[model samples]
Target: MKAKIHVSAAILATLCVISFFSITLLVELFGTLDQVAWIKSIIVFPGLFILIPAMAITGATGASLAKHRKGRLIQEKQKRMKIIAANGLLILIPSALVLHYWASLGQFNLAFYTVQVLELTAGFINASLMIMNANKGRKLAHK
Candidate 1:
């Protein structure tokens, strides 16, 4: 249950970021073309699919570790959060770097910058939430 929650939280956060950039790009450039918006959703799936499973697995591991944390579990919770964030960032880095290179090659404009910022902020918020959820689970486990 904790693992599932962690993954869901992480995925939700990541997707929120993706959705923000995509929807903003579409609305600004594409002007809400109904079909195109749908396409944007499709574009998100590949990342989502890749991330969801990994997060789930990581979260499961965290849950298992939590069981072992026993008395001084808060320390373990912090450790797990750091691990999860690092791993998640590792998963994200390659695609982000590639996308950065591509964007540089494309010479995109201010809107693109705004979209990137939005996406990054959203992603951070999401990752934070995932950690928070994991902590919440830890607290629950303690009780």
Candidate 2:
């Protein structure tokens, strides 16, 4: 149980770090709005090095959590995650709007931004559920 907490926290922490850089890239994208040449979108290429590990660790954590717990608690955790994830989608709407409408942002290279988008998208959604589940686990642990 302690291990799970530590691991979850680590994963969430990593997610937060990823979110930070993704935002940095977004702001840079926005700043470059007027000058965002199409070919520069290729710059997103290198960032995937960070994105892939984040994804794999996140997936592995989920798999491990499920393997570690076998009962109604896991089911409850999963159910809560589903609900939070739905709300998490709402979190992205604003981002989508900013990315799509704001003239400066729209001018930026889509491919260059795609890496940031995917990182932020997955990080936000996964972190939301992971945190929620972690909190739920804490409350249950107290009982």
lDDT of 2 by residue, 1-143 (tens): 74565456446544644454455556565755543322123223333344345444544565565775667777877686565445334543334434444433454556536744664665566556666766766665565
**Residues 1-143, model 1: lDDT tens digits:** 65566556555645644564465456546563454334334444564566556556655665575665565555555565665466446534433444344354553456545545555554565556565655666575558
Return the lDDT, model 2, position 131: 68
* Model 1 lDDT at residue 66: 63
Residue 112 of model 2, lDDT score: 37
CA lDDT scores, all candidates in order: 0.53, 0.51
TM-score of each: 0.37, 0.42
The predictions' CA RMSDs to the true structure, in order, are 11.6, 7.5
